[model samples]
Target chain A: MDERQLKRLLTEIAHEEIPDDMNVWHEIRQQVETANSRTTRRGFRLVRTGLLAALFVLATAVAYAVYQGLIGSDPGLDAVNQANLVTTIEETQELGGDYDWAVTLHYAYADANRITVGYTVTGAAPARDQLRPFTNTLLRDSTGRQYTWLPVGGGGGGGGGGSSDPDALVPFEDNIGASFDASIIDDAPESLDLTLTIQLAYATEDARQEFGPDVMLPAGDVTFEFTVPFIAGHRYDGPQTASASAIDMTLQDVVVAPSLTRLDLCFAAPPSDNGKPWAAFADVTVDGNVVVEDFQLLSPIVPVADSDCQQYVMPLSLVEYVESGEWTLTIAALRAPDTESPDTVIQRMRDEAGINITPLEDGGYMFSEPLPEDMTAASAALADILSEEQQTLEGPWVFQWRFE
Target chain B: MASLVERYQVHAARVAYLITQDRSQAEDVVQAAFLRAYRSIDGFDPRRPFQPWFMRIVVNQALQTVQRDRRELSLDGDRQAGDPSFMLHDPGPTLESIAEQTELKQQVRQALKALAPEERAAVVMRYYLDFTEREIAAALERPAGTVKWRLHEARKQLRTLLGETEAEEG
Candidate 1:
């Protein structure tokens, strides 16, 4: 194709049919008005200090109630609390003014490697279907070094027990709790002063689905300042080697922290015909109990820098930690990503499992019938194909470490 | 200010979409770029064309967003494998002319995805936005020679990826 043709094609690609009702200017005006109102109300705080104190006390009580509710719900935080690593913060700060939002910092856990903070928001909630409240967080150290904070796991909304149906529209509640995680300071300082700034905002259903930025509520940004003493973890550095199926593997290190366990491993596998990268998955056990229930879902295997190695960081439950005991990490299997195209995979499913999948207009497939509760036959067939497509070298490459 | 947003919002969003490959993320990038431009408008020279100055912010924002997403994905690891129930299926045939155009666009998109983000930016600025090499260099804050080299390499890669032979230079 000539440059003219390329230009035409690209120009066509660039042609986006923007909706007529997308009034970005209106949103911007709303933000500007909110900012101006906040500025004007900044001076009225001194006169309301006594009232603010009363609210603070009430908020503290509410926060304790919320904390109690969260204890048995979140296993990770429960484990951290059981390990005596959680620092409780019961103070409440009001977003104040027209936006009657109150935020309470419930608890925090920090180590040299990671940090987790939990908080609850209480106020007038937006409509469930139209709008949702979201907390945009920024974490910075005393030196003003900002770290990228992300949601620890999927469920961000809490407090209301909604329906199990995916199609159900759950109502928004006045109180909700959320937890955020970030990789904290690497160098272990005795203690570090940190500030977490959370901006409470509302997002329309469209915006949320589009991943658009949230519209800042009229309330000002809430800041929580706390000092977190760095908790250190036990690290075992080794060149431990094990071999199976003519492949040699090495365990570089293992780090056992209050929040999670990390394993650094290196190995070389024979080149596959499809040329996809190989990944090593392992089963971890602490005192004869399996630490990870599903190796494929929760464990994140990250590639080590400048080496043919992968580092797996598995989150620990309360039962996985022992004050003084042995931890065994057994490499169970090696697998590669599916190299087959989606159409091919679907065809194979139809031919082998007798599952007819219909293509939807949105490029997704729908099963001809509701899937059976027991998928043993379908799963077994897929597993057979998967084993055939990817070479799996099975080995009980075990590395044991005892920590006190 | 409203006029400026109205005039440039579609173009900016489209360019961002080409770079980020996500409609919502592209819109977010455009919104942020416009906000940034509004805050920094005092620094912009009145004599200069606003399109290039504004587009520079859009390109940079898109690139930064892409980079940040890559970092997050690396940390998060690959998402769960596609469930058979929701797997993507092949698009069937359509009207001949429309199908040809759709196929061509899909091929171009795949080729663009294969290129580096920076390379994609250079191509979008040069061919899609019709920015001259000097204009692109000024917008990107790079040397003219570097801009030319980037455009050259990007074009060569696109050509090879698209399975097209040498074409006349613009």
Candidate 2:
């Protein structure tokens, strides 16, 4: 209640410690040693390239062959990422090092616009709901130009799409497909060199249950560099229209390729909207069969030409299309964020959270009620208000595009 | 360096744990902070104390994680492990006293949870870690006025929450 009491309580909280042998000290030591050794090895490789060139050549050949066999020589586009099998380049390389994990590049799809690589990692169980934990990927060409990844709206986008089910796959196995935007390079050559470096760690069983962000089993860093050949594809531009409850959007262009299907959408909404311009396309039916079966999002609202409305450049999974059949895009919802007054937001919070928000002189609101005995109930109340603001604008906007 | 980690791991881990409320996350933050500090040990002034400097890194890492995930503070006992007081206290205590202490701890934690991450960090630095406002501003890379404002706002909320508790008691 008073200053002294508050200090004592906080100090007590600060001093709390978990009782266990799970201290990460040993792990840290191992990581430090590994890093030091890697630095030494890199130094040797750079300085003694000529001297070890022959030996390195022989070792690389053997390592590559062994690695290809470990994961399987033919990595067909299976359940991981439905990359088109016709245009996929299945190249398997073994990132041989001191890594406790094994990674095999199953297949890759590359074009002038984008590059998507599918790979499977065998190691300790991965963190649930997390993809590409400490993974760094770069695509480069002979010109020494590097391509960065475009924003993937989902949580930890570079890891591609997967089920959020915590028990979906065994912890030791993670199948991930990463898509990178190559739009930065004007005319990408027929092929580009991709260097994917990932740092992963095993999560302890307890850490898995608690889902601690920092909890790691051990430090495992590996780099895979391989050439990905691109395949050319056709582009379709249309002024297709879709509407739902005062929300309307046009499909300006769709670039269909083996690697990724990119759709450029020009969206138009009312002026008094605060949310990001997003249409939740629940499914896309091609030839009377639904092509898009998963819940994919295109958000973080990239703006179009200097307008209150925005443009969404959505890159979707590969799908089969018929030149004469009908195509229907089923939009589940059009999401526009809340742009209401602070009072309105507070009223909504009160209505949902049942908590009182009092305005401070500094123009900030504070929760004034007795702290809810049920913390979950209190957070749930606040979370409801937070979520409500995100989905302020909603509608099912369906659009159709026909090909002759 | 090993000795330094051994000596400061508990304190650094506790600081991170209080802010993030995840035991494994706290350990990770502490490890990262120590590694960062270790990498720049030459730049550190040996004349100055290391607790605040090291703790500043711990707080930053924890704040970054919270911002990235937007995780809410929880008062759930199972969510977090370790009771620093448990180590310092005698195992035997009057059952009623233990219960009362736990209830009070929970109430205080709940009230603290309501504060934003920055405000919570300010309170912890000032009252929990005993950092002066200027020192906290320096550690957090903010002006002294900002630290004071955060503390003032945090204390007001804490007062209101605890005042309501007192009224219930009366």
Give me the candidate number with maximum TM-score.
1
lDDT score at residue A45, model 2, on the 0-100 scale: 10
lDDT of 1 at A381: 49
Highest DockQ, which number?
2
Report the C-alpha lDDT of model 2 over A1-404, residue by residue, as the tens digit. Answer: 45567777766775555432224566555554444333211121111111123223423332111111111111112312434432344444444333335666666656644666666665423335332222334456556766544333111111122222554432234445555565555563676666665545444446656965334554555666777676554556687777777767676766555444566666666543533234343466776886664233343222345753333334443434735467776666543333335576578767866775543332223343222334334444543454355444455656677654
Error of 2 at A292 (Å): 6.1
| Docking outcome class, model 1 | incorrect
Off by over 4 Å in 2: A1-113, A116-149, A153-179, A183-190, A193-226, A231-237, A243-248, A256-261, A267-270, A273-311, A314-326, A331-335, A341-396, A401-404, B1-170
The residue pairs found clashing in candidate 2 are A15-B84, A16-B84, A17-B82, A17-B84, A18-B82, A125-A171, A202-A217, A275-A337
DockQ-derived CAPRI band for the predicted complex in model 2: incorrect
**What are the Cα lDDT values of the candidates?**
0.56, 0.51
- Please give the distance, in angstroms, between residue A209's alpha carbon in candidate 1 and its true position after superposition: 11
- Give the range where candidate 2 chain A is weakest over 10 consecutive residues by summed lDDT: A65-74
Off by over 4 Å in 1: A1-75, A81-85, A96-102, A122-129, A143-154, A159-192, A205-220, A243-249, A267-279, A285-294, A297-310, A318-327, A340-397, B1-170
